[model samples]
Structure formats: structure tokens, C-alpha cells
Target: MRAMAYRGPYKVRVEDRDMPCIEHPNDAIVKVSLAAICGSDLHLYHGMMPDTRVGHTFGHEFVGSVHEVGPSVQNLKPGDRVMVPFNVYCGSCYFCARGLYSNCHNVNANATAVGGIYGYSHTCGGYDGGQGEYVRVPFADVGPALIPEWMHEEDAVLLTDAVATGYFGAQLADIAEGDTVVVFGAGPIGLFAAQSSWLMGAGRVIVVDHLEYRLEKARTLAHAEVYNFAEYDDIVVELKKATDYLGADVAIDAVGAEADGNLLQHVTSAKFKLQGGSPVALNWAIDAVRKGGTISIMGAYGPMFSAVKFGDALNKGLTLRMNQCPVKRQWPRLFEHVRNGYLTPREIVTHRVPLEHIAEGYHLFSSKLDGCIKTLVLPHAG
Candidate 1:
């Protein structure tokens, strides 16, 4: 079978690799119907993740058909379609018992912890990911949920990542009725975060990003106000102006670089920092936050160590809750959102490419061109 393997740092190639088989009783085999590229996958490509070396199949968000399941997998069968949860938890761990499935003691616990994850790393369970013809899914019975009857496979793909991350972001921010919220980054995660914030009763939701196209999408589709970081010399001023001189009650960082740094300098002063950008979302939120606001950092943090100005954190008395999306905990509820037609996170998908054209897709998406918010890869469509 052919898999898009990381032949080297930033060098991805489509190559023949062994097809995966069920190696554990709790495992299930998914025939790759569709898989979407994620922001985290970029970390691996840039060689920022641990042991993200040659030959790793890179992808975690997927909606696929179950072609086989082990005997122990009762709820799921060969014919049932499901969305693979990004996190694999045994549902009985110290963390899982408390509903903190992201920190599952079994699969993908933390680097300072123990866990497993598909195609992530040995530190993340070193399990094979779903970027190939067939990939094994661990903890299948407990992890893989049937795609709700009203959901389409492409649309349900968000349940595997972006939408879940969005819900996770708003939940962390403690958004409530009549609260004004701000989301930095208009990419898929940020877009979803804005939608989720509005759904959670936020009085107003504002999305900040440089892309005019993205900002338009946020306003027209997600129905949120947008701030063009590129146009405004000071985004804080611009965002505050939109929010009555005060800041938003909650600020969610969906762009995961130096916390929200973009490619170019001067779009944000922090973006041009020679001292180094450190989750500018922290600084952006601090600058544009109401006195007692909440900051939620849910973007993928790479290994390169950096620092944020916590002085603002102390002064603002902001409640900082940071974590990767514990998809295990957010999936069920997000699916509920999908079922009600309250949220359609997949609407951000701008590119749907055959797996073989991943190189082209990656280039187009990495460039953020033509309003390519997200790209879905169909590995077995060939």
C-alpha cells in the first residue's frame, strides 16, 4: 500500500508501505475514505515534533469506514462508519476515569506523562496513523463513535479535530451569556472557535486574522465580526474599538506558532519581535481583554521553547487554561452540535484533493492561497 511518508524534514513523499493489521484486541481497521490535514501535521513536517523523522505517515483527523474490527470491538462492526477520535484512551485510566481523555494514561498522556497516538510518536503511543490505505485504530470500541445519522463523512471530519478543538477552546474560556469573546486566527481551528463561542451564548464574537478572505468567511458564514490584523497597525486598538474600548471577555488562540505569530513581520509588533514571538495570542488577548477576561490556548505547541509575558496575565487576573483538544471529552458534545445543525465546521474546507496530489495540496494550503482554509486528503481514492 502507498502512504504519504515523511522522507525527511519538510520532505514528504508518497511511497509504498506495509498495510496495517489489527495488532490488539481493542483495535479496528479503517479503510481510508477521507482524511483531513491538520495544523499539527505541519509541526511534524517542519521537524519540530519529537522523532518526526523519515517514513512517518502524518495525519490524525479522519472520517472513514470500518472494514474490520477485532472480536472485542462490540459497538462497532465491519460495515459501520465512524470518525476516529484523535486521542486514543482506554476509558479506564486515572485521567479517563475523570473524563480527561486527552491525558489518558494509556494513549497519548503528556510528554511529562505517558500515552499513545496514531502516527504521532513513540511518546504519543507510536501507533500507525490513518494516512494510508488501511490503518489500525487502537481502543476502537471505546474511542470510535458512529458518525451520527445526520452527518456526512466529509462534514463529520471536523469531529476528529477542528470542531472539537473549537468547542474545547470555548469551553476552556468559560464563555457565558452576554460575554464578548475574541478568537485569534481565522484558520479552520480559529473559525470553528468563533462559531463555538457564539453558540455558547457569547454576547458577541470577534475573529482576528490577516486574510481578508478568511475575515469575510467569518462574517458571512460564521456570523462573527472580524478584525484584519494586516490592515490595523495595532490589532488591540482595532479589536478594542470594535468592542467599546474594553476587550473581549474571552480570547482564544487558534494559531499555534509563537502563540499567534504569522509569516510576515509588522502585521503585529509581536510578529516582528527580534526577541522572539511567544504566543502573541497571549499578548494580543492581554492587550485586548477585558480586565477580568479568560484566555484559552488550544493551538498545537511545538518543541521550540519560548516564553509569554505573564505580567499581563498577573495584572489582568486572566484565567489561563491551556491544553490540546481532549477530543475524547469534546467529541460526544461536538457531535451533538453537528446533529442539531447548530455548527458546520467542515464549511471551512476549501480544498479536497486526491491523496496522490498531497504535495500540491500541501503547497497550496501551506501558502494559505485561494482561501484554502483546510484540505482533506483521500489516500485510497486512487
Candidate 2:
């Protein structure tokens, strides 16, 4: 099998590797048909996440056919086409029973925080991801869902992470009808969050980003007002003005770890590793939302302490809700939305690369070249 292996920061390559076999009674081996390079994967590529070991394959959003399954995997069989959520969990765990699958206690050594995530760093769980030709899925019955006959393969793959997490973020916001929501970052997650906000009855949606291309997507795809923070002297103040000086009813932080507005924060977190992740976007969220409003976070961050505005949030009586999204929990409604033609997840896809050219794909995405919004990996492409 050929897998994308990490050699060091800013380095990865396609290398021949041994194929994974079922290691647990509930495990299944999937022959990956479609995989995506999530924006969060850049954290590992840039050495932002801790314990991202060399030779680790970094990918979490993927969909495929079951190549093999253990005896205990009763819900699926070999040849079943499935979409596996990013979470790896035991369905009967305390957290899983409560629909908090991302925090399942039985799957990860770091269960005190996040549960097992495919291809994320060791801090989440050391499981290999689906960036290769195949991947082993644990607790297969709980996490893998058969792709609906009406769904496109591209939509099924995005549901594994980006679409699900974005909708979850908006759900956490508890948006009231006619509320104004402002989303920070215009990546796929942010774009989806902005779009989802409208479905949740938000009267207005605004997307903030420094990139013109992404802001353009926000305007067209999400139907949200757009802002380029780079053009503002103070983006929070600009957001306040847009909201008639009271601030938005809700604010969301979708940019994590590598947020660029504050140079010192970005240096301390991303370059120097002094903080868990840059809190510029989060702080902006706190400042941009009105008093007693909500702030929902979907961005990926490390486990260490970050320099955030906790005191201000408390003073303003803001509801701060954040967690690694319970991906499967958001699927039912998301599936309905996709089926009804309310969303076409594949529209956000800008680049598709063969598994062998993934290193170049990573470079193109990281460098923000070619107007790249989302990049899909074809593991079995000719």
C-alpha cells in the first residue's frame, strides 16, 4: 500500500507501507475511495500539533468501501460502501450514550479531553488516518454509516468532517430567529458554518477573512456578507459597526492555531509554540459578539493553555460553547439538508489530487495557490 507519510515539519511523501489488518473484534478495514485534506491537517503538516510522529499519515475526512470486517461488526459487511465519521468511539460508552461521541471515554488514552480521531496527532489518538489506500476503522458499528443511495460520493466524504462540524458549530450557537451571526474565517468549515446559520433562522450572516477569494466564496456560496480583516484598522470595531454598534448576536471562531491578524500571538503560538494556539480569532469573537450573546468554536486547537479573553467573556455574560464536534450527532439533519438540495458540499471542492501527488497538493493548499478552497485525495485514482 502507498501512504502519505510525514517526515518532518513541511515535509511529506507517498511511500509504500504495509496494509492495515483488523486488530479488534469491532474493527473493519476500509479501502478508501475518497479522502480530503482538511484545513486542520495543516496543523500537523506545520508541526503545530504535539506528538505528530514521523511516518504518521494525516487525514480524517474520508469515505470508502469495506474491504474486510471483524466478526463483531454486524451492521456492515465486506463490500458495503460507507462514510466513516472522524470519531472513533465505542457506542456504549457513557459519553457516547449522551450523543457526545467525540469525547468517548473508551477509545483514547487522552479520553479526559478528545476521543479517538482518525489520522489526528497522538494527543487525540495515535490511530492511522485514511490518507492512504486503506485504513482500519475501530468500533466500526458505531461510526460507519452506509452512504445514502441519493448522496454523491463527494458529499458523503465531506459529511465525515467539514459539513458535520460546521453544522454542529451553528447548532451550539443556539441562534434565535432573526439574530445576526458573524463567522470568523472563510475556510470550508467557516463557509459551511455561515451557510448553516441561515438554515438555523439567522436573519443575517457575515463571514470574516483576510483572503479575497474565500470572502468571495462566503458571499456567493454562503450568501453571507463578507469582510477582509486585512483591510480594516480594527476588525472587531468594523464588525460592531456592521451590527449597528451593539455587536453581532452571535460570533463564531473557525480559525484556530494559525490565525494571522495579531503577529505577536501568531508568533507565540504557531512559530514559538509558547501557547496552545493563537487566540486572535477567538478573542475577536468575544469582542465582536454582543453582551449576553453566544460564541461557538469549531476550530482545532491543542491541549495546552491559550491566551484568551476569559475574563471579558465572563464580564459580558457570553455563552462560550466549544468542543471537538460530535460528527455523527449532526448527520441526521445534515443528510436531510443535502437530500433536499439545500447544500451541495462538492461545490466547495477546488482541487482533487491523486494519492501519489499529495505532497504537491499539500504545498498548493498551504501556500494558498490556485484559489484552493478544499482539496480531495483520490487514493485509487489511475
Candidate 3:
């Protein structure tokens, strides 16, 4: 098997590796048919995530066919086409029973925070991801579902992470009817969040980003107002002005560690690694949202401390909600939305690269070149 190998920061290559076999009674070996290079994967590529070991493949959003299943895997058989959620968890645990699949206690040894995530760093349970030709899926019966016959494979693959997480971000916002929602970041997740806000009855949706292409996507795909944070002297103040000086009713931060606005924050967190992640987006959320409003955080951040505006959030009585998305939990409604033509997740996909050219794929996405929005990695293609 050929897998994406991480040699160091800003370095990765396709290398031949041993194929994964079922290691647990409940495990399944999935022959990856479609996989995506998520924005979150860039954290590992840039050495932002802790314990991202060399030779560990980095990918989480993937859909594939079951190559083999272990003795206890009864729900799926060989050749079953399935979409696996990013979460690796046991369904019967307390958290899982409560629909907090991302925090399942029975999967990761370090489940004090997030549960096991495919292809994330060791802090996320050290499981190999599906960027390779094959991947080992633990608790296969619980985490994967059969891809709907009506769904495109591209949509199914994005559902494994970006699409699901974006919808979850909107859900976490608790947007009321007629609420004005502002989303920070115009990445796939942010675009989805902005689009989902409209479905949730938001009167207006605003997407903030520094990129012109992504903002253009927000205007066209999401049908939301767009703001380039780089153009504004103070984006927070501008957001307040847009909301008639009261601030937006809800704000979602979809930019995590690599947010670039404050020079010092980005320098310290992203460059020097002094903090867990830059809290610029979150702080902007706190400042841009109205008092007593809700703020949803869907961005991936390190476990370390960040210089966030906790005091302002408390003072303004803001509801702060954040967690690693429980991907499977958002699927039912999402499936309905996709079926009704309300969402076209594949529309966000800008590039598709063969398995052999995945290093170039990573470079394209990481560098934000070629108007890249979302990139899909084809593990089995020429």
C-alpha cells in the first residue's frame, strides 16, 4: 500500500507501506475509494498538532468499501460501500449513548477530552487514517454507515468530516428565527455553517474571510453577505456596524490555529508555538456577537491555553459552545437536505488528486493555491 508519509513539518511523500489488517474483533479493513484532505489535516502537516509522528498517514474524511471484517463485525460485510465518520468510538459508552460520539470514553486512552479520530496525532489516539489505499476501522459497526444509493461518492466522502462538522457548527449556534449570524472563515466548514444558518431560519448570514475567492463562494454558494477581514481596519467593529451597532445575534468561529489577523497572536501561536492555537477568530466572535448571543466554535485547536476573551464572554453573558463535531449525529438531517437538493457538498470540491500526487495535493491546499477550497484525495485512482 502507498500512504502519505509525514517526514517533518512542511514535508510529506507517498511511500509504500504494509497494508493494515483487522486487529480487533469489531474492526474492519476498508479499501479507501475516496478520501479528502481536510483543512484540519494541515495542522499535522504544519506541525501544529502535538505528537503527529513521522510515517503516520493524515486523513479523516473518507468513504470506502469494506475489504474485510473481523468476527464481531456483523452489520457490514466485504464489499459494502460505506462512509466512515471521523470519530472512532464505541457506541455503548456514556458519552456515545448521549450522542456525544466525539467524546466517547471507551476508544482513546486519552479520552479525557476528544475521542479517537482517524489520522490525527497521538493525542487523538494514534490511529492510521484513510489517506492510504487501506485503513483499519475500529468499532466499525458503530462509526460507519452504508452510503445512500442516491448520494454521490464525493458528497459521501465530504460527509465524513467537513460537511458534517459545518452543519454541527450551525446547530451548536442555536440560531433563532430571524437571527443575524456571522461566520468567521470562509473555508468549507465556514461556508457550510453560513449556508446551514439560513436553513435554521437565520434572517441574514455573513461570512468573514481574508480570501477573495472564498468570499466569492460565500456570496454565490451560501448566498450570504461577505466580508474580507483583511480589508477592514477592524472587522469586529465593522460587523457591529453591519448589525446596526448591536453586533450579530450569533457568531461562529471556523478558523482555528492559523487565523491571521493579529500579528502578535499569529506569530506567537502559529510560528513560535508558544500557545495552543491563535484565538483571534474566537476573540473576534466574542467581540462581533451581541451580548447574550451565542457563539459556536467548530475550528480545530490544540489542547493548550490560548489568549481568548473569556472575560468579555462572561461579561456579555454569551453562550460559548464548542467541541469536536460528533459527525454521525448530524447525518440524518444532512441526508435529507442533500436528497432535497438543499446542499451540494461536492460543489465545494475544487481539486481531485490521484493517490500518487497527494503530496502535491497537500501542497496545493496548504498553500491555498489555484483557488483551492476543498480537495479530495483518490487513493485507488491512477
Reference-based lDDT, each prediction: 0.76, 0.90, 0.89
Taking all chains together, each candidate's TM-score versus the true structure is: 0.91, 0.96, 0.96
| lDDT of candidate 2 over 1-382, digit per residue (tens) | 9999999988999999999999999999999999999989988898877899999998999999999999898999999999999998899988899999999898898648899999998898899999999999999988999999999999999999999989998999999999999998899999999999999999999998877998999999999999887777788899999888999999888888773223356544332221223587888899999999999999988765677889999999999999989998899999999999998999999999999999999998887889999999999999
Q: Candidate 3, 256: how far from true, in Å?
A: 1.1
TM-score of 3: 0.96
Displacement of residue 114 (Cα, Å) in model 2 is 0.5
Instruction: Score candidate 2 by lDDT.
Output: 0.90
* Candidate 3, position 43, lDDT: 78
Ranking by lDDT: 2, 3, 1
* Candidate that would win on lDDT: 2
Q: Tell me each candidate's RMSD, in Å, in order.
A: 3.0, 2.6, 2.6
- Model 1, residue 32: what's the lDDT? 80
lDDT of 2 at 360: 96
